[model samples]
Target: MRSERRHVLVTGASGTLGAEICRRVAGTGWDVTLVVRTRDARAAETARECQELGAQTTVVAADLADPGSAEFVVEHARATIPTPMAGLVHCAAHFTFARVGRLADDLHSDYLRSFDVNTHALLRLIDQCGRHMVDDGRIVALSSVNSVLGLPGSGAYAASKAAAEALIRTASRELGHRGITCNTVQLGLVDTPAAAAVTDAGVRDLYAMQSAVGRTGRAEDVAAQVSYLLSEQAGWMTGQTVRLDGGFQCR
Candidate 1:
């Protein structure tokens, strides 16, 4: 039997990875609510793409860093969606490169900003979704391989992502009784606009060499994994961090 189409909420809908996830999920015939931080040209383009795929789409501008934003987003989504949301893919994250020395003064705000969006916002969204979603809802959050790899100059970002994963694990246990699954996907070097902006040819080559696939990952690669995790086939999986690093963590 064909599965009935469902509604999904995707954060960071304007970025490369998030936009691809929105497109991929919509292509699967699911209604999509894009929780973008800003209603930019990119968000509009992504929404247009999803609509073209025949999936109903709604774009909500929200900054996850703000304490009240999650509640507002939940209320907006509940009003806009024709049915209960079945899935939430949190792809929004704040990252700024800095060393341990920067943790003391003005740069302290950097850590706070990262944690506010990467960890606390995720918790707030999941809590709201838990109260409203139908049984068997799926929740997926985007993490980075740096969370575990202990990469230098990534202390704050890694700490925030690691904390997010810890929260997801606990959430899975708590929501399991309701048939909801929470999981995190850890990504490595992906060929996204963000990476392109920071990575030079030498750095890209280094990352490619470390991957078993001998090439960098694409945004679509991460999107495919998220799409699977949101499907009924992944109902039995929860409280786990799935890695899409092309074996970079193994090396």
Candidate 2:
């Protein structure tokens, strides 16, 4: 077992999927710097859990929507963590349900916000954090199947995620010479608080039915995949968008 502790920066660290990733990485001897929009109780709890798992934890509150937040997060992590950052996971996302042509007045702002948080922030983090990473570094972003499927009522969200995937692909190519791997995980209907807020129980059941696995995704599923991508064994994998949708896209 690899026991050397490496440092990692995880955005959206207070969200369900982000928190799960933090726990999984921490258990595998990775110290974590959690970048949250607010240093709330939930963020504190996540840091505590990682520390209990014997991982050094730092919580830096920065809203990714801000153009400069990415630089601030990297600098803060560099100052706090003793080790050079080995991995960066961009888990923070902005999602809004706006159908094209239906909400013309609101769609423009929504689209801008989505791209700002999802696409631009990921790019900025890759630029800021990527500079601080060691050789064989890993960069993973949590994307959505909507990026490809273009699900109805998710125009803004889908477009932003698609753009993020493209940026990851480019980053992978540009950073490959340094042994840095950049990838995205296109997720399906995961049972998360964010999902619950936007979808109803009926919608959830329908997603479960559509999935080939006959169930929705779990946070553990995402965390497991993230752990693998961050591992030294995955050094050769880059510029790929691996789907973790429980075969939902197959149907």
Q: How many residue pairs clash (N, CA or C atoms closer than 3 angstroms) in each of the candidate models, in the order given?
A: 0, 0
Give per-residue CA lDDT, model 1, range 149-221, as digits (tens): 8677788889999999999999999999989999999999999888787678898888888888898999889
| Shift in Å, residue 48, candidate 2 | 0.6
Query: Weakest 10 consecutive residues, lDDT, candidate 1?
Result: 1-10
On residues 6-64, what C-alpha lDDT tens digit does candidate 2 reach at each position? 99999999999999999999999899999999989999999999999999999999989
lDDT of 1 at 230: 94
Per-residue error (Å), model 2, residue 186: 0.2
lDDT of 2: 0.92
Quote the lDDT for 79 in model 2.
Answer: 93
Model 1: runs farther than 4 Å from truth? 249-251
